[model samples]
Target: MPGSPPNAPCSMRASICALTCWCSDDTRPIRSATPRSSMRSGRARSSRPRPRSPRKNGSPRPGPHASRPRASRSTARTGPGRSKSGSPAGPCGSIRSSPPRSGPRNGRAGDCQSPARGYPRGMSAPVAVALEPCSTGENPLWHAGENALYWTDIPAGKLFRFDPADGIYRKVYEGEPVGGFTVQADGSLLLFRVSDFARFDPATGSLSILRTFRDEGMQRFNDVMADPEGRVFAGTIGTDDRGGGLYRVDTDGTVTRLFRGTRVSNGMGFTPDLRRMYWTDSTAKTISVFEYDRATGSLANPAIVHAAGPADGTPDGMVVDAEGNLWSARWDGHAILKIAPDGTVLERHAFPVAKVSALCFAGPDLDQFYVTTAGGGRPESQPLDGALFHLATGTRGPDRFRSRILL
Candidate 1:
């Protein structure tokens, strides 16, 4: 978030500048799926000026229920569908919710397979895989081609990979702080950083700027995911007074701004059926789902599936399970939550570290869950803090779509 890109082109700034700069003239009215209350301003400095008018109140308010997030809604109609319980279901099935629990039921495996069988010697807790701790370990991605796992230490500007077969993990790239990245179809990397988004090659340590932000002081990228069509949806972090933005980088090399005032867009994933998309806004404390249109790459009708309570730690990176359930990592809560579609807490997997940043299903069969942690650079660091964790679970998640950018 602090560093500037030393290598970037000048093509992207003009068209996308008005979107984040929040200028009054060119700032178009967006059909935001998130509520205004959840949105904060962005920190990107805008050189343009706007005339101010006297306002009696903060901003004009919309009518009642006009922008309220719905708790229950019908699912997208990808095709014929049925609940896991096997009751005949509609294409637009709505999940019924149980009352929220005040606290995580420690060691409770409501529906997921227990961790006891996931370890070699029957160790139930998550096993840390790294020898040293990362400053802000995040963005755990599975590279199926290499049969290994990759993650990043954001503050340290380090990228690392772990091979379970030989029990080896090392830094692969060390440059500017990389917020997130995706594995390309050709095995290259699409890196989203503070100054620009680019393509990175591991074998030759080569990186080329695909597009660069016009402004160097804009917020840095945070999390990104490749859609079923291989388009990437990326988000940026918010600054002190402003929220960030959510953007879609098309395969044809077009950039589109999907939402503004996004407060720390942290994680994203698609449903098993590929008809819906799950998004997390950490500062808003809400996980929202959208009806997705794969043909045109758009989202609509956002509903809050899970809203974190005061006790629920800030939600960070997230992924959808094979069964469409969502697993979210807690920043300060020291646990990973497996949540049902109806927003019920199915399982709570606790870790020794306080900052559980992100997780993904990896390995050949995609049966293992790789996790990342943060706060390792702190003076009072724990043994496992900032280390990558590998847990062999009973479930398998779908492979992330191989990116085909600039197609």
Candidate 2:
């Protein structure tokens, strides 16, 4: 009675009394004596007949068939009584919908779902080997002199090297988180930790800090590389309230800030002539080029070279081939894109895992492409998510320039 309409008269309310009952027990039938069409029309009066008025003593007169209880109407309705689309409502008054039988359903395009683990469309399956599952693996450097490969597990604070000839994997160093590093001219390693720059001597197994950052509010260094003249160009992230900046560290250990306002500074590379520099910002989803001055380690006239769409993934680590084509590792797009100098995509290589962290040219001829991945936050079900992968692309590139630091 409380939820019933308030404006109706007693006779009308009595005639519609059965409709007021809530179907609390779904197993029981809904008590409705009114005709289906009349109930659908929501009208109170019936066209068949009108019962006699109550007697003067206040007792209602008996109808012709009052003794028998009326059969309840079916809960299901059709025609005009149905929903606007002519479909019956669900039990909770909501329209039922089904999932699509085929095609992309999550706003992603059809191409994003790659077919195989190592092979993308139009490409053969590259050989992928699990050197070691790492939390965050980066900076794959192939030492031609030693005929071995070296890489870092960032969060694990460990350095690893693998020898293909003997098939032996060894841990060479254990220290702070190494963001990036460069091979020195003297066969040592120039390491850039989160807040400091250091040099590690593999011959003697010793690490010496060259420079330490004193800015407590600045985030750790994200990427680093040495120029042909031995100048270290590095970038740092910022605190919650500020953006990061790029810096240059000279051979004499003097640091100079070059540019600011970068949210997530990442991979960087220089052209063969050392005139144009390419830098990527993963958060901005853009790869920008600048007129570089190798003499002063300075950058100017910044312009975007490539910007990824929402589904194209963020550009992570990158490298420049001998022909000047840029190979970029896609962070979440599950593919790598090779772009020409004019910003045209020349090739695309897809992977089964979604997080492709970094790539570089390896092997004696620099014809092998080595890839690194991140397993820090990935689910355990992803088998190849954080392993190293490589492929012979039949292309050559210059070797990694040695760092000439005065140690």
Candidate 3:
């Protein structure tokens, strides 16, 4: 990247500021962060082709909708009283520093250097998968057949898919706030919205309702996942007095309620072996595990494995990795928690902004992590709070189970 432009675009700059880089030289004790409420997570790799220009979010300056970042001491601005030279605005609006960066950079921009300090220096910084943040980004899914990533902005009622190959993305649906969705065995998307389910054709952008609820008002599919047998376990954000419920939607169209006591049903995932199912309840601040029966599609022996105390952030969306570990997003916590199968807090990847809503593994090899966040539509949200981000975590993830619900 020797000839790379002096002014990196907003995507690269945004990735830098939010990066919590680690290194070998500096040895500092990791301080304990008091856990609190939370929710989700990015992409750059050498194996892929170079990215195209950042046209959608390449604005060097902050727009009326984007949050303003603080200027770097070495940044020069073009306006009247500013120096008029240096890099562009980064995440949340931070200006790029004029000084040269040293070390090995993980992504395209330059040498690897942490925007701040502390932690083993990783090889790369988290990449901004989507510069345009969401107002409730959740449910990231990697479609190997299409070689792309898909996710939703719940409040905005928009669905988007991104191609890692060229750094290009397009909005696929815009009529409803999709709480969760799964790629069908045939490759179409089965969208679970507020009160109904839709079959979405990504290729043509055409969608048709699959099912409609009669009395489940406000009982949206908050989050869900397909079981190993093409069945889906859908959790809901039920009405005030009723509380959220977890239901099973089978291929035959018969629905069964498995559990019915969560305040806000959030994320769900299967254990690597498919023996256990993990569920998150944001309002209850807990990640519970249940005995999963793939043959019967029933859940039993439910137990609270990881309960987030006031200090620990509320667990939002979650997924199981290839290693049998759980990676969960913390709402308002500003970090993603990597939890062990036994529910131990293994590691925490911090974010620059709050409202980290959800994440998933994407990329051809399934080694990259794509994250989503919320609060993008709010005037008080942080710069990158609503943006979709990614990182090349040296870990592979399990394949997402496909839903085969008959229409």
Residue 112 lDDT, candidate 2, scale 0-100: 21
- Winner on lDDT between 1 and 2 is 1
Residues 1-407 of candidate 3 have per-residue lDDT tens digits of 01112122222222323322222233232223444323322344458555455557765544446776754322211121111243333332212221112212344333222332332234133444465557788898989898878888788777777665544455667777888999999999999888777788877766777777534534678798988898888888877636688888889766777767666888888888889889887877888899988789988898988988575567898888899889898888877887888888876776756787888877666766788888775667665667777665557788898999884
Error of 3 at 35 (Å): 17
Tell me how far candidate 2 lies from the true structure as C-alpha RMSD in angstroms: 24.9
Ranking by TM-score: 3, 1, 2
Alpha-carbon RMSD to native, per candidate: 23.8, 24.9, 14.3
Question: Please, what is the whole-model Cα lDDT of each candidate in the order they appear?
Answer: 0.68, 0.64, 0.68
Model 2 ranges off by over 4 Å: 1-124, 376-381
Candidate 3's displacement at residue 357, Å, is 0.7
**lDDT, candidate 1, 1-407, per-residue tens:** 22223221111111111101011222222211232554458876667655556567888655444777653211111222222354423322211111102211224443111334222221134545453367789999989888777898998887776655544455567778899999998998888888688888766667888887632224788899999888999888866325576788899767787886655888888999889999998878889999999998899999999998776688999998899989899999787888898777666666667888999988777767788999875668765577677665556689888778874
Model 1 lDDT, residue 305, Cα: 94
Error of 2 at 36 (Å): 61
Candidate 2 lands at a TM-score of 0.67
List TM-score per model, in order: 0.70, 0.67, 0.73
- For candidate 3, the lDDT comes to 0.68
Model 2 is weakest, by summed lDDT over 10 consecutive residues, at: 8-17
